[model samples]
Target: MKRRLVRKLLFGAAFICLLSTQAFAQDGYRMWLSYDLIENPDKLSEYREMINYVSIPLSSPTLEAAGEELTPGLSGLLGEDIATTNQMQNGTIVVGTPGTSDLIAGLSLDDELNQLGPEGYFIEHRVVDGNHLMIIASNEEIGVLYGVFAFLRQLQTLQDLEGLSLKSSPKVEFRVVNHWDNLDRLVERGYAGLSLWDWGSLPHYEDPRYVDYARINASVGINATAINNVNADPKILTDQFLTKVAALADVFRPYGIQTFLSVSFNSPVDIGGLETADPLNPDVADWWESKVDEIYEKIPDFGGFLVKADSEGQPGPHGYGRTHAEGANMLADALAPHDGIVFWRAFVYDPAQTDRFREAYDEFVPLDGQFADNVILQVKNGPIDFQPREPFSPLFGAMEETNTMIELQVTQEYFGFDLHLAYMGPLFTEALTSDTYAKGEGSTVARVVDGSLFGYEHTGMAGVINPGSDRNWTGHPFVQSSWYSFGRLAWDHTLTAEEIAEEWIQMTYSTDEEFIEPVKEMMMMSRDAGVNYRMPIGLTHLYAQGHHYGPAPWTADLPRPDWTAVYYHKADENGVGFDRTATGSNAVDQYQEPVASRFRDLNRISDDYLLWFHHVSWDYEMNTGRPLWNELVHKYYSGVEQVREMQNLWNRTEGLIGSQRFEEVKSLLEIQERDAIHWRNACILYFQSVNNLPIPNGYEAPDHTLDYYKALEHTKYVPDPWYN
Candidate 1:
């Protein structure tokens, strides 16, 4: 009967509403580094015995931080304080670089240690003089810090430390979180209350949140973060704010998270009192160089500029009829002296009539190999914006000589804000694993961004962070998985969505298989479920204008045609879907070989991408034997059903996980149900008005008239900051 109850609860998400009670409310600022004590007696004892003593340097800031974290982390997990030792003894955990610890230098691990680059680590258990020892050694101090965190993670997840032999390293060079936070504390496209920076109190008041924030990021292998929005403000570079930014840098230095800024391209004109901010202008270049010198003085280890040049209304070299290479190269020259990088954003679109997906490629591919060595073009995962589903950006493999990185959005600006639990792990993995077919069939976007395919030096994966001042960090409990997913993937792109979700589950929630099994399944399916209910099967960017919360398929009122739903959908009386084939925009031609050919042929295209590449008639036959209109409608309904499945599964985990978090997720799931229905009803009805098609017999009818749904009174709703 208990098994039967579990089955019903797991599948149906029954009693989801019961999770909303006050008894379940929790402040979620801890994030994934919850050093909760282990309940398993055997594993706890083994872990305690393995890490009886820690021997690390007392001076190096990075090593000091590693010791601080390890001491508390082991104490919390083992339920006792661990002893430190200078002498090599049994059960001694020696953690340091070769230069710091002579014991580590004499390990004869030269060959094994060489495989781990500057920031990789090697953990091994050895015995000398019958003394059981665990050595966490690395080539650099930062690598030892990472190894220490790995050791703590084992404790957090209750993994046996006995005979632990593990070697790990980040595949990418730079892993950063790009915060779209403004100076006034307003987070653009942010849904979780306010920005986490607390600019008003910063530079003076050292908020403890900054410390924990760094700790959490370091635990996940994230090494850098840009505190400001990519749509930057020139004032951030001013002397006053630079001092403030430096203060935050001092706090993060110990944890190895470098600070970066999103620079306004027109800084010379806005802040330097210059007439023209042209890249070619000597005075403008001098101003940037002088300012970078000031920044480095205030913060020596600064990660350089993240420029959103010529994109949106942001100023760039385009104003002077200069190429993106000319613009990026100018800044790269300035930052090169300081060993800094320029993350030039490739999310560009002009007012001209063209496919939005093709614009970034057209502008960037021509400038390949022209950029300075330090300049890396930061490309979004998809060709289009961060839609529910999109083909990999054509620019990934197209630019061989240029360095590149992937930028993923963790905030659900278009995925239902903080109200829905849409895990983004699957979405991230899907884009990373997409085969670009640039060098060959195996030349994937992951390889392109990781810098292996192009044989380039720099590589990175950035997440537009979702963390805010909300009690739960991200307003929804399950939404935390996206944050975890981004960090884990940025460290190593090879990890599966399911693996990350399961690891996050063990650390973030419960370790019990019962709780983990269903929750892991829910997180894995969340992205697909959201795509189903919102924009499934390559139907991209059809959300309500401005707010982007609900459906607005009929909207064509935006200033730019490309900004509206009608621009991308191109739905009419004939059929629904865009045409990007040779007859259409020829965006498919941007891809190499077999990929382009497969996308061009209707018979060969994946059904998930049919609407993306080709415009089909309503009566056109689908792979599933359904007509185009019927298939589209079926997909929308299938997405809604998937959400219901998520809700039921979430509701059933109430007793297994913490009551407060369980109920919190339950309430979010309830909100998701309504949002999913809104997406389904509004989209189906509006499309029905155009196609004049009947709803399949099994699906539910529209909840209200199209006008009723359209009349959603949106008051001061601005989804994207640039929308205004």
Candidate 2:
């Protein structure tokens, strides 16, 4: 009897050990969708009681995706297996479109749904048979899928679901992610890892990763995706590639996410065998119309084309001496018949132009009202490329006749790559909330992009997505907040940066109040810290050639004069910074009278953006009562100090968060500290070389010479996927 009892006890212990090992193997590839087992038993019990079963009536791909996501999430979170049913049971959660479910149709909710639009959903709790039931209803099946994710999010955030009644809708019509991904699976400016789309195995072997990708995107407010780099390949429009694109579109459709293509402007001539691709030419117009027709046939709900014509060596109507309006309107006309819109990029600049910052404004402001109704001129946040700190683009309110979409880079191209912990939420808010003062005092860039300022029909926001095939989605785990923040801001631009950081922290790391507060502070200060250390006081674009890794303030001899770091900084013994006032580049004159005048006066200009508009003497007195030279030195030193503080804050969190994530962040903070010092040393050393100024009394001098800093090269820097 003793021997039998011993054998049974040993078997039970072995079985329990195997289960523990299985649980440990699950990494965070699922991201916030992980739905890990809830640690709080009382909370788990309550969730299980609230969600006992799920009823999904619709059976489309998106509907199926919703069902698939819900089962795993609920099973993991509630610690119970929640079965799916065709009909609503007592205490059931019914999720479907109004057309398919009687419970949804009979609620007289169609009118409310019309107000909510096709992408919105209504979540309500109804009591039937003395049992409470939750209903997630939408005007379309895809909305139902979004509703499911929304419901799950509320649970994940530990929000009260009892007596829940809410109708949520996207403020913008189109919230899209522009992936600078190439056919070779490389992502341009993508620091995460390889491209998420497995092109080599696509159109045949459907990777499950694609489905998860759509699920996470739908969970946020992202409704559309442009799959290729804006500097596009004409071959993508060929028949063979259409099949591959169609396959991915089908995968995304059920999640309410439409797929868009970035088409090369010369596709008509390059792919259709036309002699010339001029917009006014009849054959060119006909070819585009036919090509769009072919795309729509393959994927009926294809979003549209994202064109980078006449920008950065890409072909456009400028090649034929035609206006940008003519080029965009031609594509707009082709897509108009199918209800598709054209996103014409306003990133034009010429290498030959003396002032690169003035190029886009000069090119597009003149042809503002000539674009077709179905076209949106996509403008980057700043006049120049995605610099760490820049003045708001003059084009935001300049083009009143055309629809505008704010293009933001979620990827940290100029700010620091994945190695540094820079949260871009504050950076995004700075640009969005900046008062352009075009129509009036309250005319902000957010209002311009959301269609409220101009009172135009179409307006939207697009972020260059930072996702890659890395196990953590984004390379640095914390960098995921930038992606999340972009979608949240796109959904509602009014959200404060602090609020977004709090939400991301609670959902991503821990809901524990202790972890949330300090981490939120760290995220809030991160962007400004990066700016101070890397490019303080409005100095811009001093990154090294090609890789853009670190300081290269002395880089003056590149093929294009504008490509050099010195072209922007203009640091010398006399002064530092670009002169964009009336006397110099006159870039500030592009804004309204009040804004331009405010920037014209060096005293009136904010010190943060002082160098962006005006070149000042090294001895100029700043508002801080210190000379410009002293203030600049203080900012650089303070930036490095702030990075050390971030590391200290993270170290205190060692035992408070998950071991794996904590260790990952801890190591990243170390890298960030080292690089922050590198930035401080390199930038200060180079500036001191130009200014011939001594290092301030108390601050430490750089350990190396300016030549030593310049000799450092990153030849092994990974080329953006598209560049390769």
Candidate 3:
């Protein structure tokens, strides 16, 4: 009898060990699709019983990806092994194109599916033969694959499964991420870790990370990605590198993602054996067409090129006395036959121009209607390069006949990198919701890009991805919110920044109210706080030369005249701001008359953008009746105090979350506070020197001398990942 009891006890112990091992195996690498066993197992028992078997027909690459993803997700979430069959069986979850599955055909979904486009899906749960059946149907194989992921996401988020009727499609025609990665596996402005792409082993040995990267992007609505930096390397377009790119395209294809490359405009002369790359020359045009055809042969669904030309020393049509329209149209015509589109960058500025901010609008606005139907002008959120705050780019509504896409920087290049928790959702919303007054008061940047305002054939959005090979993906845990926000906004721009932040916090962190509330508050206020301390009153481009880390208000020795801080702020005894009004740069005239008139009036303009539009004196009275200098001082002090408050708020949540993540976040916040003070002090001191004014009474003096701030250099700083 004793021996029998020992055998039973040993068996029970082994079973418990198996269960524990299974439970602990899940890591968050799957992101929101972590389909772990439901906490309320009873609530999901019906789905477990109904989805015991899956039948998928027409084994295409995309259908295989759906099968590979769904089976594992279901096994983990429901704690049961779901059998796959070639034919429909009782309680089968059928997924495929209309003709591939009888269930889909019987429902007469082919016509409806055809209307949903290549990236759309329809999910329906109905009873067949007295047994419950869930069907994922689409006109194309890739759409079925997307449906499978969407169905799994619903389960992961604990949504209802019965009587489900859902049909979904992307509002924008193209959703892409532009990676500024170099051949050396370094990411430009990347703070996370080393680049995810392993260029050294490409073509010969493809990394599994490439497949994983596609999976993550597909989970969101992102359908296209440009693999290289805008600063093109002609070698990347060569036959040798084409093979490597083909390998990546193959991995991404199953996930419904296409690969794009940044091309050198002078590649015909630099990489090819041709004499010149003039767009109007027959030889040059023939060479480019042949090159594009060659690329398409290797990767059939390859997205077209992204060109950054005539800016920062890159070659362009300007080199051949042709307009940007002629240059982009040449490439666009080549890619048009293959259902591809070219994304030409509009971040151009000439140092010789008196007003750098007005250069892009001046150059491109005249050629608005000249671009090919398949070309899009990808403009930055602001006229300037990702400043803390600036007026919306005038280019948004200026082009009525051309397609446009808003390009946002997801990586925190200017906002303390990965150290400070600066959520960019607010920044994005600020630009999107700004009334351009092009068509009327309600004409927003979001409407302009969504093709609602201009009624263009194509519309899209691109975020400079912050993903790296870091263990946590993005370097700072909180920085992931920017990526999350970008995807959510791309899907539906109407969603508020607060709603997106809360959703991400709940999914990635804890769902408990105590943990969610304060963290959400921190994210909502973080962007404004960074702006207050760094570039309050719309002053910008004041970072140190290379690294762009801390403050450099005294930097004035750069090669170009506009490259220095003094050129932007223009702080002197006369005034302390850029004069873009009618009297100075006349940059405001680029906007529509109503918008220009509003900004031209000092009383009518918002304080956030006051200094950006007008040059105000130090002693001038603000709307608050305080002198301009005093208001600036007050904002800087207020910013430092807010950081301290954030630190305290974080301290209270120590034991509420995991100790490892909590400690990592706490350390980063401390670093941000220190840097905030440095920005406040350095900027205030420099401005005080220029204005010859007294420091506000309550504000603190500089901890170090102005000379000390100027002497500090970053020769050892990391090079931009794209440049590396």
Best of the candidates, TM-score: 1
Arranged by TM-score, best first:
1, 2, 3
Which clashing pairs does model 1 show?
Answer: 12-648, 13-648, 19-663, 24-660, 532-639
Candidate 2 segments exceeding 4 Å error: 1-26, 40-42, 85-90, 110-114, 126-129, 713-724
lDDT for every model? 0.83, 0.82, 0.81
Expressed as tens digits, the lDDT of each residue in 441-474 for candidate 1 is 8998999999899988789998998577876677
Model 3: runs farther than 4 Å from truth?
1-30, 37-58, 78-94, 110-115, 124-135, 162-164, 713-724
TM-score of 1: 0.94
In order of lDDT, best first, we have 1, 2, 3
Residues 377-423 of candidate 3 have per-residue lDDT tens digits of 99999998999998899999999999998999888898888788899
Q: What is the TM-score of each candidate against the true structure?
A: 0.94, 0.94, 0.91
Q: Lowest-lDDT window of 10 residues in candidate 1?
A: 11-20
